[model samples]
Target: MMPAEQAGAAALLRHLAGAEPIETHVSAVFVGPDTAFKLKKAVALGFLDFSTLAARERFLRRELEINQPAAPALYRDVVPVTRAPDGRLALGGEREVVDWVLRMAPVPPEDFLDAVAARGGLDGSVLDAIADAAFALHAALPPVPGLDAPAELGRVLAGNRQAALAAGLPPARVAALAAAAEATLARLAPLLAARAAAGRVRRCHGDLHLGNLCLLEGRVTPFDALEFDEALATIDTGYDLAFLLMDLDHRVGRAAANRVLNRYVARSGDAGLTAALPVWLSMRALIRAHVLSRAKGPGSGLPYLARAEAMLAPPPPRLVAVGGLQGTGKSRLARGLAPGIGAAPGALVLRSDEIRKRQAGCAPEQRLPAAAYTPEASMAVFRELTDLAAEALHGGHAVIADAAFLRPEERAAIEAARGGAPFTGFWLEAPPEVLRARVAARRGDASDADVAVLAAAAARDPGPITWQRVDAATDPLPAVRNALGLNPDDPC
Candidate 1:
């Protein structure tokens, strides 16, 4: 070994010999042997404290307790340091206790996802393993109480907005951003409440990035979870997954992010999460922006801030109205097109079915009573949908409005919201028989329409539209790609 490496080994030995291990280590962490010990810093942050030895011991115990479930084999135990009669430091089994350190069997740094990605050795299988492991972990977490859900979510959102404003962001832009966040939360409040009632809010890893994950023995393992703040770690599962999504977005991995989301959702059977993803993703972006903004100046977060700004920068907004009768795959096409147009984390998809269901106090598959679909209710849904799309677009997001916009006035409302922005009007069309078959095949959906409804929509005159027809016979993603004038082979 070189002089520095030899010096590092000596320092490690000295620290190991001490009764109370020192927190500071001058040596490189990864260069050391397979086994590593970590000591808590004797400092106190607002959400965490290790100022006292007892506090550090408490947190160490908590870390072991929390991590053992997900990574039982890796987390060895929290062992106390003790002094010998001869005034020599030793680990455990001594007469008198001095301090405590969390002991663990360390894995190689090469096992990390970032390291693999850097070496161009990452593959879809690795990503799949990660998604599967994360999904399983999420499923195992205990749900938080319903009453605390809204307040906790509100605090997170408000804190981010306040931080941006405090960081010297333009007042108008800050207010606009705050309004956008508030509006999205308000729109999804009911859905969030329902999910909370269904126990979707759970104790989770608050910071889930590739760097926190590793491939151990061909299985993905996540470590270094948020051990300090239960309030931060306990959140809606979507929020937990959003961190990874935001991380992928920052790395310019849009397709991979979507694939992870799709795969996780499929495995977990959490379709309701789809409706909640945009809200969580937006919150994640804003949180990252806030963290970055705070990192400005010497010995601060400048480097991280620059990266966050790039990730949080708003995308050019486009309004794409999906016009078709029920079961023509409007929603599918809109989802497919969203990631392709807007910035990876900035795309805003506004779905009429989801909005209507939220307005009607029911799940998507629940049939809307005749009273719920009154002219006034329908008008309210349309107004809300357009309002959301316009707000999202103005906030630098691509908006896809999915609805059966059979009436010219409905189409006009959407067009007026575009406000000279580049727009695409996708008119998904299928034969009457195909539409009926598609609607019938759907097990659970918000649309109450049937064959008659499709027949009536087809009979109605669709006024002049600058729209492209999507053949239902083929995959809608390819048709959307072609309509957007993008390469069909584009991985997005």
Candidate 2:
């Protein structure tokens, strides 16, 4: 469209939004009381082009087409902003199609996850919601064949390095990060190709971040998928989720990121993707650094650069297990110490209760039959836990095993799995009355232990134990800090 046409369309949209138009690098968003009108800016940015009227219409149609499955309720339509017969303008008017606008159900400003995080309102439910949304989005879509993801990912990484270099970031750091990325990508090339070959690549929400997610009707759903380029949007499913994990680690805390990761892995059963996650996370943060560098110049990129380095720097892997009676707070201590351990976001927590439920083909909160807890079934759960821990540990990630290891052999299985890694075990203890009270207070936790289970555990002799004990009547952070050798005043 011409300048006059674009200017007129923007003016009409602003009138409807009843406020100043929100501008980004590519588009202007006008939010009304209940609706939002977005018009792409007319500029050729090399990677994307909305410079021509036809290109704008094409992208608008593509946005509507691709975002339907992911967020059909919020993405309303691709309507044209037309000039009226008079000097006025309106949406979808009888006048010629002067320009196009993407109309959507307006998500409230406060409903975005970033906004919620700023308000200190982000919770585990929000993480679960995000995992569910991403899993559902990927589950239904079949992968697109012939996606040269290795090459494309390489180009994107290289572009990030070039952009950072052009913006005058620390050259040594940029080169080191770039070299690390190349090495990771080299090692992961086969897996990437296999994922694409196995049809794990699909049309994805390219921009999966906190800012792009909103609590639509109290559920988190991703909006604004990659619409400008098919190659960029067609990606490995887990790779798409890395952006979200990266955002959580950077914007929220590492623990929040780990919470989301564990939830998504359990829900999606995509634990095999952990091998490549470091690369994806580092690459994502580097790209973010480049964006900040190019947009704000110099100092703005420092924090993001540090975050990228942190993603690549794997802390020494350790195997830490929390075991005790039903209400001894094993799970709480495990979670408390998880994010403080090795690797990007933290440890891979493999809860024995969840493993047992999975083995029984039940949900985490569902109870299995009494027979399902037999010695044979118990060994199977332990084997699964050991295997998962071994895989995570070998991949340079810390492991947190949460379970009631009342039996001496159950404890031995974890020890056997650790191999050469440093091993630490904590037994959380509380009074029997306190344990009963804790059991009574349980809601939707994975542990199905009740008073009877606690009494059974008390009845059993697990032989001589060597692990340390933690008092479990209060928060477990202090004990965890002492175990990890962090000062009491050290900020997490």
Candidate 3:
């Protein structure tokens, strides 16, 4: 299409939408009452080129193809903006093709994850759903068998360094980031190769931020996947997920980010990915910093640059175990303390209940049969919990083990799982009536412990509780935070 035809198409899109388009560097989206149209700009960047009508149409079609499966209700057909004999423009006319457009159903602006987060609406349920959506997308994508994971990440690091320098960011900091990232990548190359061989490298949603997510049909759906560049999208799933984690850490809080991370790892059973998390998170932060520096100014991105540096040098990993009877609020205390534990997204909370549910091939909220909770099965769950805790600790990430720890042997095993990391244990206690009432009022939780189960647990003497005892009749977060030396007001 000629410049005049492109101009005509743009005008027609604006007119049809009855508003100005939401413009980006590579595309413009005009959202109407019921319909939305996205048009690719006729520009060519090094990574992606949509300089011709054919290229634009191909990319638009590809976008539809890539996004349709995950968000079927949001992505519609690709249509062409056409001009008639009278030189009037229409969406799909038989006269002459002006430019191609990706048509979509308009989702409410307030429903987007970014908007929801801005209003402090990212509660536990919403955060879990977002992680679930990401997990489903990653699981559905086919592995890119021959892709070189380390080499691909190396390019990302190199490109980010060049871009940061070009954008006039502080030269020293940029250099430091690049150097640290290079060394980290070199260290992780072997692990990356092994993960790739295990089918952990796949085509994923390259740009997975809060803005690209929305609620579709009461379900969190991800849309507008990176479609112009195949190489950029084909990456390790952990790196792909790191984008969302970093975004959440920056935009929301580390607590939200940590919750999503734990949920994803629990669902995917990919705990080894934590080894590369810091660097992946740093890369994500550096990219955002450079983009912001180029768009706004150097000062706007300095914080992100600092964050990029911090993510590379996280605090030493630690293990904290919270143990109690059924209703002592162990899960609640773990959730509250995880954000303050260690690292950017905080500690991984490995709950025995969730692990048990996973072992039984059931959802976290599903109730397991009585047969599934035999002593042998329960011990197996504890063993798996200790294994996972050790894995996360070895990867230089903090962990909080949430379980009854009713057996003295189980306590010994968890304490021994910390290896060289510092370990802390909290044993919670509440009145029997409080425990019974809390268990009775529960709904949609991973724990299957009921009043009868609580009674049975009380019947057994848990031997000696060596860990610090805390009252659980009220909130225990403040006491736990105090014990861990975490500021109550800040979640770093």
Q: Judged by TM-score, which candidate is best?
A: 3
Whole-model alpha-carbon lDDT for candidate 1: 0.68
Count backbone clashes in candidate 2: 0
Candidate 2 lDDT tens digits, 1-492? 324547888888888999788788888889999899989988887789988889999999998888877787799998887776676778886677878999999888899889999998888777777877887788878879997778878988888888889888899999999998898888779878887898888888888899888888777878888889887778888789899988998888888888887777666556666767788898888878878888888789889888888777676788998988898888777777777777778787889888887677666677777898888988898888888888777766778888888888888989888877899888888888999999989988888777898898898888888888888878776866787785554324
Off by over 4 Å in 3: 1-5, 488-492
- Scored by lDDT, the top model is 3
Candidate 2: segments with Cα more than 4 A from true spot: 1-4, 84-88, 93-95, 145-149, 194-199, 356-380, 473-476, 486-492
Question: TM-score, each model?
Answer: 0.62, 0.91, 0.96
Q: Ranking by TM-score, best first?
A: 3, 2, 1
Error of 2 at 291 (Å): 1.1
Worst 10 residues of 1 by lDDT: 22-31
- Cα error of candidate 2 at position 262, Å: 1.7
Per-residue alpha-carbon lDDT of model 1 for 57-103, expressed as tens digits? 88889888888888877778877766678866566785676666677
**TM-score comparison, 1 vs 2, better candidate:** 2
